[model samples]
Target: MKRIKFLYLVIGLTIFLGCSKEEITSIGQQGDYITNFDFPTIEIFAPAKVGLTNRSKNADKFLWEFSGAKTITPQGDTISYSQSEKMVPDSAFYELPGEYNVKLTTWKDGEQKEITKKIVVEKQQPVIVVPENIGVFLEVTFAARVFQFPGRPVSYEWDFGPAGTSTAANPKVTFTTEGPQLVKLTVNDGDETLSTEVVIIVQGELAKTIYFTDAFTRRIYKYKLTTQSESQVEWIGATTGYNAFGLSVKGNKLYLSETGFGTRFSAGDAAIADGVLKSYNLDGSGENIITKPVAASLDYRDDPWMHTVDRFGNIWWTCRNWGVRVINASSSEAAYPAIKFNINATIAGEGVSTYFASDIKEVGNEIWVSYAGTTGKGIYKYGYDGNYIGKFTTAIQSHAIRTFVVDQVNSHIYFATNRADAGHGLGIYRADMDGSNIISVDTHWSMNIGSGGYSDQGAAGEYVYITNMDIDVDEDGKGYLYYGYRAISDIYGSGNPPTLGPSAANSGVKRYNLDGSETASFLFKGYAPYGLAIDQVKR
Candidate 1:
């Protein structure tokens, strides 16, 4: 009788457990409800209305929560509310620029499921776009950026003080005034008008500027040529990487070269890659690395020593131990061969087969490269396409040309060289365009050539080397040549053969009238100058 009672109790317990499991499964299946929503294509600017579509299944009760949203009543009254009914109101409006959350909570069989979505409304305004620096007598374009709905047509009006006004979307305007000029833009998109104003500084008509770099400081400074004060120098910007050796100006940009991280004798892969060709705007803004050294490229081993931009917008620079390298500033290829030399060639004045190509310049339609190696020590001429044209003169073979500048207006070449023989002093000299009639330009000191502190040996020789020069010609065809004169510091080098004495005062930037007359001695002082350039408009 006890066994029968136990079996009956087990069967009863099984029946109760089975019924409870089935009931729970049915409840969970009913709770599996889906919620979905989507928005239409819209600009979603301020004062916008958004319409949402509901895609839900197996839910009887619904709740909509709009976080601090706004809406318009039946009589066009604006009201703020938080929660809404089962069906969202078509009059829901977002009148301010911000983010809002729209939520949907559904209930089925006492279980709740919710979904939240975000909406972003953008501010309605017009943005003005213009160049950072604008000059007088130069045409500049101004643009206005605005948003319009599908059927709305936007119109723009611009007002440039002293330069007149324009109704075109983007207007090309020129200002004759030199001071601060006010620019205003008004954009209308049928419903509303938004406006913005900005003040643009228009540089003077004859603002001549000179840019030069300091090797010790690794920074560039500019001085207004029109300033009559006592050398008021302004810092433009600082350089990156290592040696800031080369600088040039073309159009509205200044190009600079940093010779990587390590010394020329100790360069590794990192040092080669660190070498860069960079550019900046006239105000020292917008620093851009035009190109950098890469593996197997010409600049990989031979870093950029000196650089110049050609008429075709191609950047041509001389590599320290190799030949010339070129790159289209707009091309994707970084650094490629402009001219490569056969290092095994005989040491004769036949071609440009030198290990040291020092400086480069774009003269007329040709490119001139200077070599300072034991063999080819003069300037070699080449076409823009890298074909050999000829050499400047075999006479210059005796002097190691350090730096030179061509005065197109005066038809003369001013070069600085290191030679104390053949009547050539360790100073600046001038020659005709064909390299004839060479004469001394500046050999002011009696010790410029002989056994004084300016010896042709030791650190003193390097202190007197002119590595940077540029020419600026005015509208009257008169030109001025500017060059850096590094002074021999007391810490230059130890020993008596070469010393830094009172002649160290000869340091700073020296200016000449192109006729060899000293325009200004120590036009700028107190720093060791290296790379130099002038903001002369392209002729």
Candidate 2:
């Protein structure tokens, strides 16, 4: 009797399994419909006309509910068409910026299923045009770009924080404070309102500010220097991670290069990794890591030592062992490959392999890079295409070339070096573009500890013995050269020990006229400046 009961159950189970596999159902069976639809998942800007398409199967009836949407008629008038019994509804228009729901319901054989998807409409912000450079007490013009609303009249209101507010489309505002000022713009188009904000950084009264990186503190500092205003040193509040070495200012951006994971004395391919090149807005906003190393392939040879930004938006950096590398500032790659000039190969010597490719600068359409190592010591010039032009200068090759800057207005190339060599005597040297008529710019103060100078590391302790320099013209059309100076108090007379290193009285940044005359001495006193840049834009 039990075997007969089991046989009956097995037959029932077999019939049920066959029905499920075949998807065979009676005319009034439940759950036999597929409800599906699609809408744009990309940003939908209002007023947006979004089309909803049906992809349902085995459904006898369909319904669509578009939350609070209107459909445009053939005569151009918008009418409510929020709900429809059709499979695909008319194009729904989202007049305002917000989130809306789209519901699709399908019914088959007296059973029903529904699904809902969200559609978000984004607000289109008005475009605001602000001047690149703004200074305290300086009147600058701000404009709201014309954005047509077709049939509706537009009105603009600008809120320049601390500078007051304006209703005019273009407003001339004079900021009274230094630092970031949040400027907002709101546009009303009778039907919809859109808004946006931008931070307008108001700089100090100086027409030009000298930006320098302090490697010891890993911080950025600025010295506002102008003949018309008081010279002041302000911390820029931007912290550069490990081994901050280079700073370059192009337009409203400040670029920095950090040789990650190694000290200046032991930096090499094997000793380091995680190097990066980054950029920050002059106001310290928009901090971004432009490039770094890819994890799977680690090579510190691609580490950025010193960098420069060209007008073409290309960032050229000198990798200590790998020569120079170039990548567009807008690149989104995890790591950028180096343009291996194998620059050391350019020099003919056994020790050329140990040659360190140092600071790089962008002069017009060309790139100039300085190299200093055991063998070759000079600046090499390259075309904008990364092809080596020639050896820029061996004039001061006796000294380790830490940095060099081109003065187009003055037609001079300034070289700042260490090692206090006999012929050139490590300081600041200026030469013609062709490396002729080399003149001493400023070599009187103390330089880094190398072949000739004493080591200050034991006392105050210097991390890297390097000097960075830059050139910028003022509003008065006068060009000046600024270079970091690590002065030994007794370089000439007083016998202060080398361990005493850089003193507050003599160590700082030195400013000189284009013709090699000293302008300001002992600026940013006591701080050992490494990387230097100048905001050349007239603020």
* Cα TM-score of candidate 2: 0.56
lDDT of 1 by residue, 364-410 (tens): 88888766554456677788767777776546646667678888778
Clashing pairs in 1: none
Provide the overall lDDT of each model, using Cα atoms, as 2-decimal numbers: 0.66, 0.68
Top-lDDT candidate index: 2
Could you tally the backbone clashes for each prediction?
0, 0
Query: How far is 193's C-alpha from truth in model 1 (Å)?
Result: 33
Worst 10 residues of 2 by lDDT: 4-13
Clashing pairs in 2: none
